[model samples]
Target: MNFLSQDKSSSRPNKAIIILSLWVFAILLLGFTFRTSLDEMITVWINVEEYSHGFFIPVITVYFLWLRRHELKFIEEFKHSLPGLVIVFIGLILLILGGLATLKTVEQYAFIITLTGMFTIAFGLPGLRVGAIPLLFLIFMVPFPQFILNNLSSKLQLISSWLGVEFIRACNIMVYLEGNVIDLGIYKLQVVDACSGLRYLFPLASLSFLCAYLFKGPFWQKVLIFFSSAPLTIFMNSLRIGIIGIMVDNWGTEMAEGFLHDFEGWIIFLICMGLLFIEMWLFSRLSGRKVAFNELVLIPTEWSGDTKQGNPDIRFNKSVFLLMLLLIGAAIASHNIEGRKDLIPSRKAFLNFPLQLGKWEGRNDYLNQYYLDVLKLTDYVIINYTQPESGNHINFYSAYYQSQREGVSVHSPKSCIPGDGWQITQFGQRDFPDFKVDGNALIINRAIIQKGDSKQLVYYWFQQRGRTITNEYLVKWYLFYDSITMNRTDGSLIRLITSVKAGENIEAADQRLQAFIKDLIPVLPAYLPGKNS
Candidate 1:
């Protein structure tokens, strides 16, 4: 017995060294493989307030692993998995594609997948099942693509605004809701991105996930706890907005901006966390087991002493070593592949674009510094054109990007128009076979949008590599395809807006836009660089 104890103590240091060596190897490989993606994620965490919680996710994941260390120690059967190797291969493909397309989001997801594959290869299915939640939790750290974020933020803004106005009305306060704005007679509150409930939703969703994982309850109850995060965040945020509206009405507009507004957000987030605890308690009662909140949610101070010993001999799997070799080769290839620069087509700038288009006379317009910064456009042209004889006017806006691989790209009007208090009454595509541009027929997205009594007709399309795309999904697909095949991600968004006359029918507005598009298409090649340009 004395010899066994001494041998166990001596081998413990060897085990620790081996584990530390594996961890170091993992970190070094991941750093080399996902260098760009990791750097971009950290930059986002520092710069973007919505994603600030990202910095804590990995720490919490490590804590979770520590909490489960005893459970993991008991399962000592190490087996190399073919499925894991397949998954690693798939991850490598995704990484290469992500590198080729310059999509950081894809690279980040691929990194997680490859790590999961490594875990599977090291300890087989049992290890993966044990650490599944922690591995999955890493997803919260990845920043969502800009397009998805914009759409989600826009929708949250509208929903929160409506609910907030409803709450204010319940209090007998004279409040009106328009799109994402709350009108309280004296002051109006616009539910912008900051107050769109995202800040609360992301952090609370993460908290709820953690709570669900820690909660000792039925599977269904855990799922319910996790899924309740979205609705709770929306409700609490709406309540906060309503409270702000009441405060603004009674006191002043000062309650809605500056430090107080931010203070309200932090307070509301804490309240959201408290509400999650209340939910867990209620779930506990529903499960027919009355448990203290502390017992139900807190981490255990010490692990159970029921761990079983397994085979003393532990060796690194050959498959894992092979995987490392593959990773090294991929890292080298990806480094070379991503270093290739985008092919920028040579063309005249928007500065040289002609203002006069046949019968239409144009006056240039400029966006403010705030908008310019937000848009991140390489070049843009905003002009109002008038037909002198009929006194008809249309606002033409075009934004061009030299490279759309970065977060800055064309924002769909489908997302932006709604945020600006416009409601779409109708939306569809229009084709013009007779009016051709650069030997290809023209197609555009036509929409009738209204705010209050005023109505406007909008015509827009994505012009990329001489292709006229009406679908936003197609634009994204082509963006990816073109980036790989043609080495160009440059594109432009063209939008034309004209008011519908008081008595004019929709057809008349369509005709006006169609006539303008005919004149505009011929001159577009000079400004919007395409295959021909």
Candidate 2:
């Protein structure tokens, strides 16, 4: 009887150790499975200023876990859950789909999903309840997709420029605002992508969320605290621009350049963070209440480690075996996926494109080296076509990508048009049933954009595989679908721009573009490959 009891007593710690080892193995397997995405995210942290905060997010997450360690006491037992298994399967599907699509954003999100699913599988609802915040907080490290970043940067530039102009005007300084450019008589301040405040917003938003998690206050106050980061960053960033303008007007452009300019960003971020704390204090005092910094932070009570070690009832659950197998399978599958190369289709070079098409006489134009480096297009053609009869001219441009993976893909005209000091007055898609490409009716995105007294009519569409895409989001979907089903991700952006004469209406410009498209359509197939090509 005594020998049997000793054997059973020795087995308890062995069971616990096996469970701990399996947990560690599962985590390592996840890291191996998602290594590509993790590497990509780390690269963004190192290279991209906007996402530099990615490096610290993991550390912060660990701190949050430590803060909530005492709550793990509630996790007395873990059992097999069918719902969790379903989630795990869904996560696995997403990982495969994302891999097949060659989408880093999707893969990054899959990491979060799989982690959630596995956590549930291992510990069930009780553990998830305690650890949800820390786990979800890791999302801040994943960078936004390039298209979203571009769209957001463009919008923020305009907002910052407009508000900065307002601040300058309030100071009784002469200023003119056009798109994202601020004109101050002798000085012109262009609010480039770097000045878009994303560098500040991303980090501040992450910090705000963490602060909200720790804030000991009403739920509404915590919600307000988390949501305030964006406006706070934008308003302060704009103020910094305004201050730079003021300094420039008085101290010349030197104040807005070199080390001091970079220093200003850090200063603005600190000020914004300080303001958040002040807001918290003001909220605490609003209803005749007071809370100190220490009080504001909800600290989890730490107990002696006796409960953790003293409990002999804890035993390893068998769900971990399934988790182990799933993770290993995921790792092996991802390895094969990472090795797959994009399929590049054959097409005529853009340089071989004819200069003369129908009645329009085209003169080929070449972009500067800087633009070529920035665009990263595999092949492209740009030409200004003119009709000698009416002396009317139209700008025709098409950019093609042999593989739309990584950062190389179509740049939507909507995102770039406003960056060049144009305000889009009317932007929507129109069906040109009268116009056809390969007997298929064409649907194009038409826009009326203006800069000062100058106005232009622009039409654009994405030619993906064999389909014409109008919406930017839809293009992404097709990119993924085609990459998987058709083994093709090649696409092109075809755009036509024509001036809307001072006295003429939009119809006249439309007529000009109509003529150009009629001639251009016949020429596009040779360069932009379709399914048949």
Candidate 3:
């Protein structure tokens, strides 16, 4: 008698359960496969203020998917894309290569790529087309490499200091800018790492992406809104710095201390969010539309409902099954290979390095334990040499690594010097007129760094596998290359620094470093290996 009123859920075969089960299985496999990278990413999210937003990325991603759940309701049958197999395979290769290289950054990226491939595999191109934005939004969760972050922070500090100084001048307040330091007549304010705007940049950029997704606007307008977060953050942070400087100048040093400093940051961040909305309002008028302020960030018309719809039913196929096998196999294999050690190249230890080269008297120098832990170097040598004839002295230092597979690596002077209260005055590559390495003119990074009226000339480069490189970016590249081709990631950073006396010109300082290089290179190869070694 109740045949006409049968249960609809039972009739439909509970496709959602099947779909979720497949997702759970796949996600568990992914977790196991990338546990090392994922654990590190979580640690960064907890520890690094700049990337704290990473903890919320996945929750937001799931919310986005929930918003588009209506679209999934209408898909007649989930399709497995045969072509996605290639992408999944490629992701595995990247994982293997990254794991072997011990590049956690690369391994983290590979996790995203693998998930992308899995998405493509599970639902095919049509599903991919629908879910692309939510998937790609996960990118904000990954943190940049430490060196890159330091370099970026250093650059932003200088920019902010310059802008803050300009604001002081605009206010009829006198100020002198030295590197990242703003010298107010009464007080000196240094634009250190904390003031670099990175804390605002990452979070605001992530917020902009979410806002852009929900924004009802033209395609170009959405892109503009997203990319503008970086500049907007920089401008607002500079404004905050300038305001603090002016306040300190007029009021007192108390204006820049305690809860007031933190309050200023919060106010600046709120203003940044408000400015984004204002930008949308202005953009609407320019486009000849009167968009309501509240409506500016409303979900687009397209997301309201789906058209050309069909019923969704889970369908398992060969491609998806093969993907499961690959995931399981790779995860188990990686677990076994996780403990394998790096192949360190043979070389003389730095402890045995000669203190005296030629015509130069030397004194051995050592870094404190705190620096030694932070740097995580395998071996190093630090010496100060003086030529008695000219009373000239040079500071020579080199840090070596047996296996720079993960976080341990060289620290570039370009980034580290700024943190040590030294501001870079000049930075560029220079070739020696009298020195050569492997038949080519030796090139090094030349920089004039100053702190509080004291000036120093510095020369530095990276010696890796067999090549000498001046650029920090290239050092990372060759590190990966040699890791793959030569099974070696060993390298050393060579640096020579000399002071510029009150009456001495920079040329004299440069000559002192160059002469030291000539005497140093011949002795370096014994400690730092050549290409063949």
Task: Assess every candidate by TM-score.
Answer: 0.92, 0.94, 0.90
Candidate 2, 112-196: lDDT as tens digits: 8888887777656776787788889989999998888988998899899989888999999998888888888878888999999
Backbone clash tally for model 3?
Answer: 2
Off by over 4 Å in 1: 1-23, 73-79, 298-314, 437-440
Candidate 2's TM-score reads 0.94
Residue range 1-533, candidate 1, lDDT tens digits: 99999999899879767855764686598678888888999999999888999999989988777666655532233344676778788888888888888888888999889888876776677768878999899999999988888889988888888889888988899987767878888987988988889888887888899899888889999999999999999999999999999999989999998999999999999998888999999989988989987787876555332457443344445575677777887798789877899888887888777779889999999999998998898999999999999999999999999898858888889888876567788999988899776678889899899888899999999998888898877888888888888888899999999999999998888888888987888888888888755
Report lDDT (Cα) of residue 63, candidate 2: 77
lDDT of each: 0.84, 0.84, 0.83
What TM-score quantifies how close candidate 3 is to the native fold?
Answer: 0.90
Query: What is the TM-score (0 to 1) of candidate 1?
Result: 0.92
lDDT of 3 by residue, 200-303 (tens): 99999999998887776799999999999998998999999999999999899999989999899999999999999999888889888998899888766666
Deviation from native of the Cα of residue 493 in model 2, angstroms: 0.4
Candidate 2: which stretches are off by over 4 Å? 1-11, 73-79, 302-314
Question: How much lDDT does candidate 1 score?
Answer: 0.84
